[model samples]
Target: MTSPEGGGPGTPAPLAPLPPSAPLPASAASDLVLPRYGAGALSDVVPSALAALGVEGEHDLLGLPPSDRYVVMLVDGLGWHLLHRHAEDAPFLTGEGRIRRSLTVGAPSTTSTSLASLGTGLPPGRHGIVGYTMAIPGTDRLLNTLRWDTTVEPLVWQPHQTAFERGVQAGVAVTTVSRKAFRGSGITVAGLRGGEFVPADSAGQATAGTVEASRRGDRSLVYLYEGDLDWTGHRAGVNSPAWRHQLSALDHFAARLRSALPADVVLLVTGDHGMLDVAPDRRVDVDSAPQLRAGVRMVGGDPRLRYLYTHEGAAGDVVATWRERLGDGALVLGRDEAIATGWFGEVEDRVRPRIGDVVIAALDETAVECRRDFPMEPLMVGWHGSLTAEEMLVPLVVAD
Candidate 1:
């Protein structure tokens, strides 16, 4: 694969540690980096764009400079740490002034939760799409937010109006460019609705659609979604050559979009979350571990982050057992403690039960999988959705 203006793809770059930021909360666990909500976060992106577009009542929390036309591209699974690690493969993106700063993805660091935060300009607590798969209150089954169980109404599950809708109401031309298959998907209705949907099957189409939408009304906000990189990471671990090649392709796509847009248009690139390769020995299968099975009723969330719904009054035992068995490989906390740490950011009473009775966040490269519950999860090479820096820190590149 041909790389952009950066160093040759053959040149390997040293993985850089996360840039220093504000001090962590004293209450936070040693292994966790709490999501920075209401400040620099995925939720702040759209509101910041709206503010830059001169939309009234919207706050530019990210401090985005003024711009008449804005095109915000979300590159799924493009994390800040990952970008620096493979900077040679994506020269155009890592160029000086191209990256504004890093933003903390919402808790769990999963696509569904982060996307909801990005679209609604609200934390997971308010948006209600807390995880990839969460318990549907009053039901025994899990609602897969990505695949989206149609039986559940999207609007009702997440009642808040999206930032895109708010932009339209303010007379700003808002358009979303993504795969045609996602035109009216459940997640779209719940998080990204209230804007005109433009289908773009390829990178060229995405560039065309974005350029056209950016040229609309005096003030325009266009959102473009790219998921191929994330898909590649899930199938072939981020450390694989395939992922590096895909990164190069995505870099070219961004370069095309930036060059096509007018000078005055501000092009911002960001991502939902990051990923890390999980080894087979590093995984703990709950299906085979009798201690992990005791008292747990249903499993939600993903391998990296687990939500274990416990039977009545079994939450304490389940938490204790998980902490003991997993010992240092994960941080096991009850729902109240997880909320108290502000990982979910103000959990609403209505959205509380959807969280697990016992929450487990895999530390480092460890994963707690239940192959019996989610058969396909263990088969994946890459995993995310924990609070580690590798998964939680995503870039906010200002490719103007």
Candidate 2:
């Protein structure tokens, strides 16, 4: 399995100039389930919730019915397909009339990107946190968005007004019920800012906090988050006994939170992304393969999705090499081709540099791991951050 280099993750190599290249054939993108940014997507959740609460300018693009209060609970890693497969473990979430539909999360289906999209009510292109980790513009260094670089201001990195902020401006009471540790984190400040933060570390606290926050005003929006399942999935495979146990606990949490909310409150449960277990044999370690490392300047994104920032004038060769080496196990595309496919939903000019010169989205159960750059990644059995149905399809369950 792949591991990180001695310099640790996000260590930069020099950037080489990349010349223009031919776009990938249309068939290259046909099989991909591209994110539906303006339609039924995670990004549309908050906007639709705000609209349901009668916020003046917010539109219910997701077609949610009218409600005075909304409790949006994001159970991290609860993919629609995963939940359906383990329905018995989560009866409350899969019960009749609970699941409205599955929503497509943003490309590079990681928590940072999806949350930014969900909070800002905009695509990754607009929000600018394009991946879990991405190159900091004009520098060889990569920014691990979750850990975040202190020098880069969160507010400046993501300048758009969040849905929570917009809801507050429109006279709606908006609150966020999440772990106390996340109250002032970079991800929260950058994407989910501008709401009353109520810290809740346990299921009981989450239930009580969500109920109380939803009653803040006649028009209220409350967002609750639980990351236990995601943490379990990463530590253990998605279908492993541990993951299933976590699913059961999550179902109980949801049931408790739902039962405690006032009758008028609408409960919407969703997830950031899904996960699939990758066998050690299925992983191709770039650190062990010189050809795979050739022309590469730095690595970003996660194992399932790789952002290969190549050296000057090396993108074409790097893309060709990766396509040839990975063969049918991955879809390798140039940056321009990737953008044209609308995976990121109309990327901004400033955001373009954050994307790699060559992007590789894993196909099937394959993973491209760089042991040296990402030491801990290869050890994790379950992974996401690609466009597969398993990684992109999150449920939007409505319980009233």
lDDT of 2: 0.88
Question: All candidates' lDDT scores?
Answer: 0.88, 0.88
TM-score of each: 0.92, 0.93
- Candidate 2 lands at a TM-score of 0.93
What number of backbone clashes does candidate 2 have, counting pairs of residues 3 or more apart or in separate chains?
13
> Residues 272-388, candidate 1, lDDT per residue (tens digit)?
999999887777777654556789999998888899998999999999877876666778999998889888898888899999999999776778888987888878999999999
Q: Residues 59-160, candidate 2: write the lDDT tens digits.
A: 898788899899998988999999999999999999998899999999889999998888999999889998989999989998898889988889988998
State the local distance difference test value for candidate 1: 0.88
Model 1 TM-score, 2 decimals = 0.92
Which parts of model 2 have CA positions greater than 4 angstroms off? 1-28
